[model samples]
Target: MLSTAGRHIISGEHGLFRDQVRKFLAKEALPHLDRWEADGIVDRSFWLACGGAGLLCPSVPEALGGPGLDFSFNAIVAEELAYIGCNAGITLQSDIVCGYIEAFGSEAMQQAWLPSMLSGETITAIAMTEPGTGSDLKAMGTTVRREGDDYVISGAKTYITNGQNADIVIVVAATASEQGRKGLSLILVEATRPGFARGRNLDKIGQHAADTSELFFDEVRVPVSNRLGEEGKGFPCLMAQLPQERLSIAISAQASAQRAFDEALAFTKGRRTFGQPVFDFQNSRFVLAGLASRLQVGWAHLDWAIARHVAGELTAAEASAAKLFHTELLWECCDKALQLHGGAGYMNEYPIARLWRDARVTRIYGGTSEIMLEIIGRSL
Candidate 1:
């Protein structure tokens, strides 16, 4: 655990909540993580357990059967999950999908979905990335057209999180082709709909436990009421949620980096080389010193961002910058820590190997590091 003074933004209750989360994860998630990774999907039972513990969808209000907490609670779960290297797509559900539905979905939609979601009886995925689209939302090829009282959605989305297990998918498709970004709309499609299909789970280099797959909609139809917000407001709705989504990614990256460093420190101390503990070497100590300094700065900045986020003052640009910096820092720390473990780190038997593998994808998702710089530069 981080030995520094606790985060200023996390209250005593939040700490207690964090402890509750750790205990729940220890009992429910850690034991099955390797099997999930091997299977390329987390079991449905685990989601149910999280729901039973009230660990899913922390920010949804009591009316929706949620704990009625805040984003800090979501961040706590993400941090703990990352520290233990458990990637089960819960953060995507809690931090990203729940926010979109709670903030924009119609009353009937909310009532229909939120309760089961909070109970972990329902799994959700947001379909944004497509075959030919990356970083540019305007390049999307999916289309939704009205036919009487129903809207037919047709397109395929790749790199979708929770694709295999999702009971519902929030699909982003063009409602009007001529309006560019303004034409996009968020349409809720049940996975059991007539033409909806899930492709094979793609083999990934990291986060193997999270089921990432390709989803297809071929004339899949839903009632007009299933549309989120207004017909052409999907772009704005997506933009509003980007800050929290990126912040969630940043929080996970920072925690994972801390875990990698801790693993390296422990390994070095216990390891012997040339009649001395590896940590006794000046080189090892200096490398760890540098990492420690960086982690200290990272924790302080993370707290500042979390505070601003809770106050509704965090900007998309600021969130982008945080994602950029923290994910890069994660890669740097994991790489160096793996090096500190020498040959042992390269072996899958060591936790450092998994840490190193998992650290690479944070820079790519939640807006790539390159996209983050562009967003920040545009703001300046």
Candidate 2:
């Protein structure tokens, strides 16, 4: 049954990859997720294990010590991870941050980072959403001033995924004197560098196992060679890369929705109310039927988006649409699923509670639903 669902959602090499990733997650990740959530961060050993499993940065080319798989393979991993309810931050690290480096980094930078990243010896994070600026990349306060082959960076980034555990961070900062989008640039900052300090591992409402942090850079100097793409080209780089990031979030949302639906279905069937199982109630059946229909649509849309992404045809608006729709649907699914679970859903001991908590941020991060609609509306 799992294989059939896997085949429907993915294909060929990606299907095989999904199977391997699923097996790895079941064996290595699932059991530890609750413990990791309690600890507020996953152990670095798991990253190394995933690297050894060849599950990190599958889209990266073999020259960089990756599997060289396509975006479909990446989607496969995302789907499987979400299916197992693993931390979303880990997926963000292995899939999204690595893509930025692979796409924008120079040959020397790639060679230096890719091997370690692929080996799980190095973890990466993208520091963009600042304490003051959330999605407004142009209004970023982080400044990286040029000083003889090095850029002195001073700023603070909040809500950074993998922030505490990240060995490499791709920082977006303002280099141009002018405001709005043009002045921004992306720089690769090593975590070990002087003046690079990580603040507290933030307490969050959800996804506790995934490390979200606040990072501070005070006079942090990085060589000019660490600049990604070109100086003052960071805005374009960020725009170009956003489709994938949004798509990754959408994929996870879809999988999460499906998981919540499945759990709800099982719960409604097994749970007893008044005098009969909850599934016996017309309201429960109708709610689940509607959610199932939405899930089907969500899956179809996501699959189409994944195909476009694999062909390099996915547009920012389209990706945003997927992110917005699927994530919103995921919230509905979680809410209704929790509702169906009665009071049990509100308790942490139940999986639905965790699912409920985790689903809230889907709408907020990776560009809020409002931001997504604005992007799509502008395109139209």
Q: Rate the local accuracy (lDDT) of all candidates.
A: 0.93, 0.88
Model 1 residue 364 lDDT score = 93
Per-residue error (Å), model 2, residue 268: 0.8
- On residues 79-138, what C-alpha lDDT tens digit does candidate 2 reach at each position? 888876788466677667887888899999999998998888999999999888998788
Clashing pairs in 1: none
Model 2 global lDDT (CA atoms, 0 to 1): 0.88
- Candidate 1 residue-wise lDDT, 102-201, digit = tens: 9999889999999999989999999999999978888789999999999999999999999999999999999997887899999999999999999999
Evaluated with lDDT, which candidate comes out highest?
Answer: 1
